[model samples]
Target chain A: GEEVAQTPKHLVRGEGQKAKLYCAPIKGHSYVFWYQQVLKNEFKFLISFQNENVFDETGMPKERFSAKCLPNSPCSLEIQATKLEDSAVYFCASSQYYSGNTIYFGEGSWLTVV
Target chain B: AQSVAQPEDQVNVAEGNPLTVKCTYSVSGNPYLFWYVQYPNRGLQFLLKYITGDNLVKGSYGFEAEFNKSQTSFHLKKPSALVSDSALYFCAVSLRTGNEKLTFGTGTRLTIIP
Candidate 1:
């Protein structure tokens, strides 16, 4: 079975610092997605990419949150000037086409901004 | 806008008994529904999806979901629950073609007692 891969299962950062997370989607998967899950809450969509091109970013916080999927490289999500509220588990998911399809998720990177 | 609602926050069931987790959706057009499971400290795993064809969709780990258009629901069902089945389940939906941004529910924690 194909699987999505994420680096740094846990990250701890101080407030106003920068934090970056990486995700390598399954091979041949064209669509990738980023979501934020805050402690026992529902997941909120942050952004999505289609082969290195951003498909949707309506949920992203433009001021501090940015994500990029460079060609031939794993997708990256960077947060500048982090705040305490940014503490959550970031999930990376990938799917064949992304139309309510079978999306596989990585174990996720837990971010803690204190 | 598309959205998913999980009616129950938790469902406690005994091992070897049938279990069900209810999910409903609101979409502008014909919706595409999906179900995923998440274990503690792990990423979400794909369970099943309902696109078209038959209403009943079988998935991994002996899980199944029924797509009811009239009811606008896609409830996950298991004939015989196991303690290993204790996990969080999420329901999601997409409203239009190429709509990869999924609207997720608050999630339901299923506990199977031995």
Candidate 2:
């Protein structure tokens, strides 16, 4: 089936350790997005990429979080210094177009910072 | 800022009965509303979307949503509920133009009693 793929379904890191999650969008999809879900609550928008170029990142928590979608590699969300609050599920999504009218999601990567 | 609201935290219904999940929004520009369903450990699956035109829009499964501009609501409804429909439902909104990120509301858990 055509679906987005994410790696490290579950990850555990020390409080100060760095954590990185990856996602591969469906083939031919042009836009990719990242979102954070904490305690199974509302999703928080993190960033979006239009074919490797960042489109919007206003909701991103700067200073510790950064993401990129390289030409040949999968998109990655990396936390420079993991914090307890950063323990949550990170989902990656993709859409046929940039408007994200019908974006699809990956299974999500669960990150745990202790 | 674009935002979505799902007032009920959970909704209970019996199989074969009609079901409705409420959602409301606030946006500066025209709104693009969406509904998604999430099973256990899986990522969100697109159910329906309201972009333009008709006030009533049908989507995947047996679900449909009415886009009421005057009421500022896009409520999801299904004629007959199924036990398989039990899951976490989310309502989201995005700018019809420009912004591509989706702002999601706190999810509503739907349980269908068989």
Candidate 3:
């Protein structure tokens, strides 16, 4: 069984269109984090959730990016008005502890914006 | 604020030879370090972590890392390299604070020569 699951493994959208990615963290895991991998081999911190509540939203772009982890539903990361620079692989991960623990990641959702 | 640095852009090792990937970090208070491997177009796979206690920690695929508190470094090492080990390696760190997100390095590409 896969510990973390991400849906829509690959997606394509034209500029100005909206894009959304979903993640299901491992059961019993309380901490979930999202990262964006850009073409320069850089991993940018996006946001994180502790259960259904957000623990950090510092890295999220307030104008276009939003995420939510609702009770009994998968965590979602949504982007409005996609831009060419937004094309990247978005990773979702979960860990038992925020301080010191192994964070397991899903396969990632690949977004291609034109 | 916490941050990780992988000084090398790439590392090359011959099969059966020893390999080392360097990582250094800066953070307030005690640090939690982690190593992850990523193949092309895939999510990161956890390799190992150093929370506390022992300076040396063994992890998946015969890999290990040495935690040097004085140097603020946690470098990934393997006694014997394999061609299959070719991938992108990431070093990450998190502060002792319980709700912060992990800060990841840019990533080091490892090429194992057969």
Candidate 4:
């Protein structure tokens, strides 16, 4: 694919339910990133992967949030026991390399926790 | 640590007038600056980026940004504002080495008043 692709454009999940989002990076892109955009429009970096390996997980919430990018599969971000605060737009981005490369973003998956 | 700041929450410009959105950054080493625009209910679109070499870099939709190392700023500019240009603009920065994650500013909502 030429652009980053995200699944389930909109997802409405009840509080305490689980929400899962998927992303497929552009072809040949080795690095994948996930960001959360809240209603305030503040973008919070969640996690990143370098060729299916966890490159950074400091920003991820260890208790309930988890993500994975395995070879030959679309990357996944899963939120367990979702809360109202968890409602946000999840954006998936990708880049060819680590430095000085332009990162392209997907259309984003909207998650609404009711 | 790396961070970006967009001083203004909102900026208004009359159609046909020049427009400027302010941005400042702080990083450990050299900075990789970028500007992105988001229309209502749409994904972010890349505007421009300042990687190295020239201080001024041009990008899509007639947008340009000037990288000022002394001031640690990358301000987005356009010669003339158009009604269609009204959108939310974000400024982001990343380190030239080590981290590949982009730290984005709060974002500036630009309105091109007719």
Least accurate stretch of 10 residues (summed lDDT) in model 1 chain B?
A: B94-103
Tell me the spans in candidate 3 whose CA falls farther than 4 Å from its real position: none
Interface DockQ per candidate:
0.72, 0.68, 0.75, 0.66
Interface RMSD of each: 1.9, 2.1, 1.6, 1.6
The best candidate by DockQ is 3
Better of 1 and 4 by lDDT: 4
Misplaced by over 4 Å in model 4 are none
Q: Each prediction's Cα lDDT score?
A: 0.91, 0.92, 0.92, 0.93
Residue A80 of model 1, lDDT score:
99
Error of 2 at B31 (Å): 0.9
Which has the greatest TM-score?
Answer: 4
lDDT of 4 by residue, A1-114 (tens): 999999989999999999999999999999999999998799999999998999988899989999999999999999999999999999999999845888899999999999
Worst 10 residues of 4 chain B by lDDT: B94-103
Model 1 stretches with alpha carbons more than 4 Å out:
A98-100
lDDT of 3 at A45: 90
The sequence of per-residue lDDT tens digits that candidate 4 reaches over residues B1-114 is 888999999999999999999999999888899999989877788888988898999998888999999999999999999999999999999888744888999999999999
Query: Would you list the rank order by TM-score, best first?
Result: 4, 3, 1, 2
Candidate 4 positional error at A47, Å: 0.2
Candidate with more favorable, higher TM-score: 1 or 2: 1
Q: How accurately is candidate 3 docked according to DockQ?
A: 0.75
Model 3 scores a TM of 0.97
Model 1: per-residue Cα lDDT at residue A1? 29
